[model samples]
Target: MTKYLVFTVLYLAMYAHAGSVVLTDDVVNIRNFEIGYLINSPHTYTIDEAIQAEFTPAPNRLSLPSNQLDIWVRFSVRNASDSVIACNIHNSISYFNRVMDFYETRNGVILDQKHIDLFAWTGDTKLLHGTDSVLPIHLNPGEEKTYYFHFVSPAYQYFEYLILDDQHTLAELSTKNIFPVLLVGMLIALACFNFLLFFSARYKEYLYYSLYLVSSIIWFVFEYGILSHYFGIYGMRGHLTSYGLLSATIFLSLFVKKVLQTAKFYPLQNLALNSTIVLLVLNLLWGVVNFFNALDISVYFFIYAIAVYFWVSISLMRQGNTLVKYLLAAQLFFIFFALFGILFYEGYLPYNWWTRYSIAIGVTVEAFILAYLLSHRIKLLKVDLETDSLTGAFNRRTLFDQFMQESKRISALESLVFVIFDIDQFKLYNDTYGHPKGDDILKIIIHHLQSQFPESSVFRLGGEEFALLFTAENAAAAQRKVSDIRLAIEHLSLAFPESRHGVVTASFGASVIESGRIQNFNELYQQTDARLYQAKHNGRNCVVM
Candidate 1:
């Protein structure tokens, strides 16, 4: 439907210079070829002088490339239909132009002139109906009018003229125009969430990613005219776009370095990343010092940075860096869609919804992918923190944490049991066979305890001392569980000839209490330890509860 409407409007606009527009109820919107002539001059011209000046046929897209010059567009409209026609002419490229002057004239007489100052915080620059650079035109039947627009800017400009009739279409268009900018807000919200997570995780990668998200948010705000259209902020547009991209690239490099562990595993790549970041920072500072016309330069550098980051991920993934795969997947999504959006702007792809809003879609997907990857990383970090390195048993700290958590639960219907045990004459066995053998015996003991209780609840308290905590139906059931663990350890086939049993064995001590009656982990630990002392005195391998 939109393509058909655009085609009909273009067909009428093509003959607009030879004849007038035959307005009808079906002509809801017109764009691109509405302007009849374009004049690119080295100096500004008044509306009176512009009327007599020579002009050339205007194309749908024109580039204004000089800060010292101005460009003017002139067009005429007539309502041949029988009813009054109300429509709006909007400059979608208003952000690229620092100053926009619209002149409405009839019969060589100036009737209305409106000025939009891009740098101003009030008046003409303010958002109207949540849109920008709009000039409402109302014409009665048989009325003819001519309109002229003057534009001045520092960098390249894309002038997209859109005319829409005032029949609920303007509000619909406003919503479509604002949708992409609202996606930037989603990125901003994700950045805030990661920033808060950084405080709890204390991971520098999270911090870097958060900062990168913020820079990306700023870049999109500038690139899509949101800064000027929504905030009425204009001057330094080039500088903000360039600097924001560079900043984002730097932080993304940092995030890749930390997440992939490049510094530890791939020092040369890490050095390359650092060197690229330094160069980007230097360019950023140079732009700040000089008037910041380095958008092209920044774009080139940004592409180079992305290439280097991509190489690092591919190289690391090949070298068995498991985390790099996720990074590569995320970057692929961003690069593919963003490149298509860039190509669309460069006229390589036909104008369509996908090509137009590709960047917003790309960023939204990549943000969520990175967020999930970060969450998975935090879970792995938690596992590493809780498990013992040598025997793969839960550490002492984990034991205490589990105790605290279980104590907080009010729905427990069973008694909680805490058991402490150690290999009989472990020191003697170590002195006789060696410390390596002693370590193996400790691993074996943990394995047997893991068979009885969960690996998460099997704790390695210290050298050769292990613990287990679980819920039991009663004290007798808890003692039976501890005895079963002791029997499993004794049944191990490994020989420890220095012991009285001529085989590896462990003494067990247990303390049981009703659920939700716990006071402190240390108190329970002390009670279990004293019973373990009694077991040691009673015999070399026995259970004391």
Candidate 2:
């Protein structure tokens, strides 16, 4: 819809001269439009007044034929206070050539305008029902400026409009038209950035975030007239429909669960995750139902989706961490107006443009989530300081911690064995094959030994040698297991050209203790180290006690 809309807007702007709003001395009369709100006092809206919204050029309608826009409106900010007070202009797009599309989630609904025929049939820029929102500007104190708005008829909507006479600041300005674009920019940027991040990290979390961004961007496109503008979304007025909204919602929910680590935290969180899955299932069913029933349930679908999203944000906030709390706060930042809009569309309440940007608020929360995860990883990196970079295994520093653990376990159970193994000619291999190859061989051997001692905790006692500590029922069993491991290594097949003995081989030593063993691991180590020396003295490929 965009291509055509851009083309049409451009063609109209180019081939035809658009009517300019040139302000005259004191008053200005719009030729082809209506002046519902004046520079002194713009349009005022109150539900008690039957929602009177005055349009310019009378009748509050526009017919843009070859750049001749028949509809227009003027909003004038009037300082109606003792001091310079800020005012605002707000407009709601009520009707457009909306092509409906439906999708299901939670066995209910998911609304994405792109599912409409217009998305598939037309360009995104076409003049469809511009579901876009605009910002109602907050005028400065005592400022008097008339802002004019014009739109073509089919893309025009006459909804409850308001020129706010509040003391709002620039910070409190509500985005009307540019809101969607800013949201789209945020979502698209997030999508592209996270998509690339997934490529870099290649983790499921990144994929979830990336998908969330993508869904958000798609939603932006669907929400704005972009999809309908070109696709003529409503073209399939009587066909089957499904929604991309389900994918967006489900992925968003899943991403949140994963990021917050809430799924495994409690039964309720788990239940929420499961329920979201169910919602997704139900949503799919409804999507199918809507596909066949035309685009009938689109509005209901979104209403439910909005509810689910809001629930997720609330749930996250209730978790009460700084990150989750801030996330919730960010979501709440946009949710009030969104909920208000829901009230508007549901009842006679006027739609709030603020509500339309719930997704933007969502993006903010998600971005913060991303930052939190990154920082969390950084914290973990600091704690896991004793790991080999090449193999990611515990290094020398890890042994000190392990030593204390083994000490406690040994004192409690008294049925533990310690085994020490040293490569027979690791230095020779290293010299012959180069240091890099030697490092590779050591890493492989470490991996093999670590897997071999299934019941034992293996630790690298610096280079070329490793130690294991484990509990067994008896000394005999422990010795057998240790011997068997040596035999397995001797018999193990490997590809090491520098190895002297057919394959890489190591000498092993074992010491079994039920009681009256070495007082501490250092003494126990001395005993085992002696045994290891005995093995090397006796023969290379054997275990000794």
After superposition on all C-alphas, the RMSD of every candidate to the true structure, in Å, is 5.8, 20.1
Global Cα lDDT for candidate 1 = 0.74
- Write model 1 residue lDDT over 78-148, tens digit each, in one string: 77778888888766666665677888888768889888765553446543333356788888888888888
Q: Which 10-residue window in model 2 sums to the lowest lDDT?
A: 102-111
TM-score of each: 0.80, 0.40
By TM-score, how accurate is candidate 2? 0.40
- The positional error of residue 454 in candidate 1, measured at the CA in angstroms, is 2.8
**Candidate 2, lDDT over the whole model:** 0.52
Question: What lDDT score goes with residue 443 in model 2?
Answer: 75
lDDT of 2 at 143: 39
Off by over 4 Å in 2: 1-95, 98-177, 228-242, 262-268, 291-327, 347-545
